[model samples]
Structures are given as structure tokens and as C-alpha cells.
Target: MFKLPELDYEYGALSPAISADIMQLHHSKHHQTYVDKLNAALEKYPDLQNQPIEDLLQTLDELPEDIRTAVRNNGGGHYNHSLFWKVMTPGGSQPTTELLGKINQEYGDLETFKSNFTQAALGVFGSGWVWLLPDMSITTTPNQDSPISEGVVPLLGLDVWEHAYYLDYKNVRPDYIKAWWGVVNWSKVSELAQKS
Candidate 1:
């Protein structure tokens, strides 16, 4: 059975930017549901366990429609949330000088990078994610899908799902988007980029 990974930080660690209640629901309830359903889906197709993830994902579209939704939603949820948990850390420092220079190379300057990244994150029409992908690439995806599926290495992901911020920021998603940077783990981001 696939398991939901424990968070590196406490449920209340993010605070003001992301409240404890939201984290509790997002991680414990929402993410756990995905893990459970994903395990169920895989159990139904024992052969799928032997295929490469890429092959498995392609075949996902061909599964019976009833289970197709489950696999896509839950599988994507599992992948995206796992990546999300690894990329966040407590607020304290900015990106290191080396990482800042890379951001500058890709986005002109820190301010412009923030402006573009925030706008990309807030501009999504519905539930989705805004990502700062490896090597400073900024992108977004609908629902639970990952950028990795499309060939980009994800460095950071900001959840734009209302459940992520609705209780705290209410309908003002931009406020939540802006505040997410407070706890961004640029060091982890840099480490992932190097691996990429």
C-alpha cells in the first residue's frame, strides 16, 4: 500500500500564511484520501505494478472510466503532494546567493520573479497549482497533475486549491499566494535543481 508521507514540519508550522486547520485538512484528509484511492486502484490492476510510471500513466487514460478518474485524481494527488511536502521549510532565509543569481538569470531580478510567479499562481481559473520548476521555469497545472509528467523538474509548488487557503484567506487567493513565499524552502529548491 502506498502511504502518505509525514510532513517535515508540524501542522501549525506555517501559521498566519497557512493556518493549522487548512494544513490539517489538506494533508490529513485530502492527501490521505488520494493515497487510499490510489492504493485501491493499483490493487484492482495488479499488472500495473510492473509497468514503468510513464507507461502506467499512458494506460491510465484507457482504464474503465469509473476507475480512470480515481487513478488520475489519486495518482496525481499522490505525486503532487509528495513533491509539495519536500519543497517547503520554515521561514528564515532568502535564497542563497548562488540560487538568487540563477533566479536573476531566468527572471531578470527577484522582484520581477515574484511578480511573475505570483501572477502565474493566482491566474489559474480553478483548482490547480503554481510551480517554480527546476532552473527557474515557472508553470502551472490544472487539478492534481504534475509538471514532471510534462517533462519539467519541479523545484517548488504552491497549492492554489481553495482548501489550501479558503479558511484563512477566504476568497482572497492573491493574499494567500503572496504570503506563501514566506516559508518557501529555496535551499531545498536549489538542491532539487542540482539533482535535476
Candidate 2:
């Protein structure tokens, strides 16, 4: 059975950008639901339990039809949130020199990249995510969808679902996105980018 990963830091660590209350709910309550549901779905096909969430998501169409959607949504949720927690820090840091060079090569500069990425985040119509792909491309995934399903992995992703920011920033998703930048874990992004 799949399980919810423990956070590397305490819930309150991301305060100011993401509140303790919001983190608690988003992690313990929201993420836990995804883990539970994914586990239940895998129970129907015990052999599939051995595969990682990423594998389950990337091969959704190949899964048994009866449990395909459950695995897609909940398994995607598990993978996304797991990466989400790791790609954030209490006080954000600048991208690694290598990542910075790559950002410059693609977007011309970091500020421009942030502006473009922010616009993409704001453009998401409803519950979804804005991702920075390994190629330095910006993209969005609706609902519990993941970039891995398309054969590309996200280096960094911003969760735009209301459950992610509602308690703190309310209806203003832009504010949440703005605040989110302050806690971004660029080193993790750099590592992921290197692997990508």
C-alpha cells in the first residue's frame, strides 16, 4: 500500500508564505486523503502495489480499467504532493549556478522567467498546477493530472488548487503565487533539472 511521506520540516516552517494552518490541512488532511485512496485502489491489484506512484501515473492507460481513474487521480496526487513538499523551503534560496545558466539560456533571465511562470500559474482556470519542466518550459495540469503522464517530468510545480492556498490567501491566487516564490527550494529544482 502507498503511504503519505513525512515532511522534511515542520508544518509551521513555511509560515508567512504558507501558514501553519494551511500546511497542516494541505498535508495531513488533503494529502492524506490522496494516499488513502491510492492505497485502496491498489488493494484491488496487489501486484501493482510494487510500482511507484510515478510509474502508476505514467502508465495510467495500461492499468486495469476498473481502477485506472482512481490510480491516476490519487496516485498523481501522491506523486505531485510528494514533490511539492520537497521543492519548498522555509526561506527560499536562489537557483544553483547551473540552473541559473539554464534559466538564462531559455528565458533570457530569471525575472522574465518568474513573470512568465506567474502568468501561467494565474492562467490556470481552476484547480490545477503550474509546472516548470526540465526543458525550462512552463505548463499547467488540471485537477490531479501530472506531467509525467506525458513523458516529461516537472522540475518544479506550483499547486494552484484552492485547497493549497484558500485558508491563507483566500480567492486571490495571485497572492498565493507571489508568496510561494519566497519559499521555493531552488536547490531541489537544480538537482531535478540535472537528472532531467
Candidate 3:
């Protein structure tokens, strides 16, 4: 069964930028729901149970029609949230030289990349995510969809779903996006980028 992964840091670790209250609810409540639902959806499909989430997402069209949507939504949710927690840290970290080099190559400079990524995050009309692809390109997906579905690996991603920041930032998504940078685990992102 899919499960909610434990966060590396305490809920309050990402304070000021993302409050303890938000982290607790986001991780314990929201993410747990996804894992539960995904497990429930797969209960009758034991043949698919052993496949990794990535494989399921990549071959979504081949899944049984009755459970495809459930797996796509909940499975994507599980995968996305798992990675989300890892991409953030208490104090965060600066971009490594290799990661910065790629960012500069693709988006001119770090600030420009931030501007582009923030714009992509804001551009999402509703519950979704903005991902920095392994190729250094940016993309957004609606609902619980992931770039992995498109055969692209995500190096980093920002969750723009209301449940992610509504309690803390209310209606100001840009503020939430701005503050989110303060907790981004650049080292983790860099490691993912380097693998690409």
C-alpha cells in the first residue's frame, strides 16, 4: 500500500515562510488522504500493486479504465507530495555551481529563473503544480497531474494547490510563492538536476 512519507524536518522547521500549522495539515491531513485513497483504489488490482508509482503514471493509458482516473489523481498526489517535502528544508541551501550553471544556461540567471518559475506558478488557474523539468524547462499540470505523465522527470516542483498555502497566505498566492523560496532545498534540487 502507498503511504505518507515522513518529513525530514519538523512541521515548524519551515517557519515564517510556511507555518507549522500549514505543514502539519498539509502533510498529515492532505497527503495522507492521497495515500489512503490510492491504496483503496488499488485494493482490487493486486497485479498493479507492486509496480512503482512512476511506472503507473508513465503507463496510465494502459491501466484498467475503472481505476485509471483514481490512480492518476491519487497516485499523482502521493508522488507529488512525497517529493514536495524533500525539496524543502529549514534553512534551505544555495544552488550548487553545476545547478546554477544549468539555470544560467536555460534562463539567463538565477533571478530570471525565479521570475519565470514564479510566473508559471501564478499562471496555474487552480489546483495544480509548476515543475522545473530535468531539462531545465518549466511546465505546469492541472489537478493532481504530474510532468512524469509526459515522460519528463521533474527536478523540482512548487505546489500551488490552495490547500498548500491558503491557511497561511490566504488569497495572496504571490506572497506565498515569494516566501516559499526561503525554504527551498536547493541541494536536493541540484542533486536531482545533476542526475539529468
Q: Ranking under lDDT, best-scoring first?
A: 3, 2, 1
lDDT by residue for model 2 (1-196), tens:
8888999899999999999999999999999999999999888798999997778888899999999999888988999999999999989877999999999999999999999999999999989999999888999999989999988889999999999999998899989999999999999999999999
Q: Candidate 1, clashing residue pairs?
A: none
In order, candidate lDDTs are 0.80, 0.92, 0.93
For candidate 1, give the lDDT.
0.80
Query: How well does each candidate superpose onto the true structure, as a TM-score?
Result: 0.89, 0.98, 0.98
Better of 1 and 2 by TM-score: 2
Write the residue-wise lDDT of candidate 3 on 57-162 in tens digits.
Answer: 9999999999999999999999999999999999888889999998999999999999999999999998999999987889999999998888887989899999
Question: Clash pairs of candidate 3?
Answer: none
Candidates 1 and 3: which is better by TM-score? 3
Instruction: Give candidate 2's error at residue 40 in angstroms.
Output: 0.7
Residue 23 in model 1: lDDT: 86
